[model samples]
Target: MATTHADDPGRCPEPLSTPDDFMGGFCAFNFTSGPAAGSFCWDRQPDYSAYRESSFGHGILEVKNETYALWKWHRNQDLYQGAVGDEIYIVREPERCLLKSSIAAYF
Candidate 1:
């Protein structure tokens, strides 16, 4: 459910230095079930160590339904090619997923 949108207004396509220039595109993540099910724009960097690695790629998590989701990683170098990392139909139980409750209650 994530996608890169059109370029930002008045911003040059230069390297990212500050947080303001870090996010070049927009990504949308949708939740298909549970009480907090909804769509949201993930315009921020994740705390995951894998994402912090020195790499030029993007990841997407799409919730197909209540228990099924898809994850994809696209490298910047190979835009014309297919996704470098791809997985589908991942089973996620909302009630049993501890991270879900913790993150939901964090705020």
Candidate 2:
């Protein structure tokens, strides 16, 4: 099981970014802050040929706004499963444009 807190020590002071979406959007943090940091999010539908690696294991980025996007995996079931609820954030400065997940949604 997974659990999170309003005051978790590891939680970011503030989300790197937040956007409006179906899940009412979410709070995003630096990529290095999550367990799946530095990895690619692969999906199939609405394919992205430029980033496509294989048919079975590819991901797609559905940009929601300047600060958020949805990273869907190549699967038929729940698109928001796995990690970070299939949501991602854009981190500028210090991180310099790093795509990351939110602890609020992932943890």
Candidate 3:
């Protein structure tokens, strides 16, 4: 589980109170991957793509990215939403966890 906390370390986070839909100033993602059984990382930033429309029609932003966190909870519910529950990815080798090279011809 992933949650958003305040910059301070002496407070709790608030609960989900979406009356209709969406939150403000908060975004989170739990990464569960590795060579082992329960290795994981809480990534505050996720890989995202940006797009825009100009006189040349639709196009992707090669420099600007709009992916970001967009939710904020009250600083008083850390126990319920702050703790990371369940199992995560188990990593044996740190280098192999993230692919850095492309696959070539294999025999």
Error of 3 at 25 (Å): 14
* Candidate 1, 1-107: lDDT as tens digits: 34443222333233232234335553333445443245242233334434343246677888888878888877755757675655656886676666656654432
Model 3 lDDT per residue over 1-107, tens place: 34333322433233332122333543333334532123123222233523311221221223222433223222233455443333233324333433653544344
lDDT of each: 0.51, 0.42, 0.31
Candidate 2 local Cα displacement, residue 62, angstroms: 0.8
Positional deviation of residue 14's Cα in model 2 after best superposition, in angstroms: 46
Q: Comparing candidate 1 with candidate 3, which one achieves the higher lDDT?
A: 1
Model 3 alpha-carbon drift over 4 Å, by segment: 1-5, 17-20, 23-107
Error of 3 at 23 (Å): 7.3
* Prediction 3 global C-alpha lDDT: 0.31
* Model 1 lowest lDDT segment of ten: 6-15
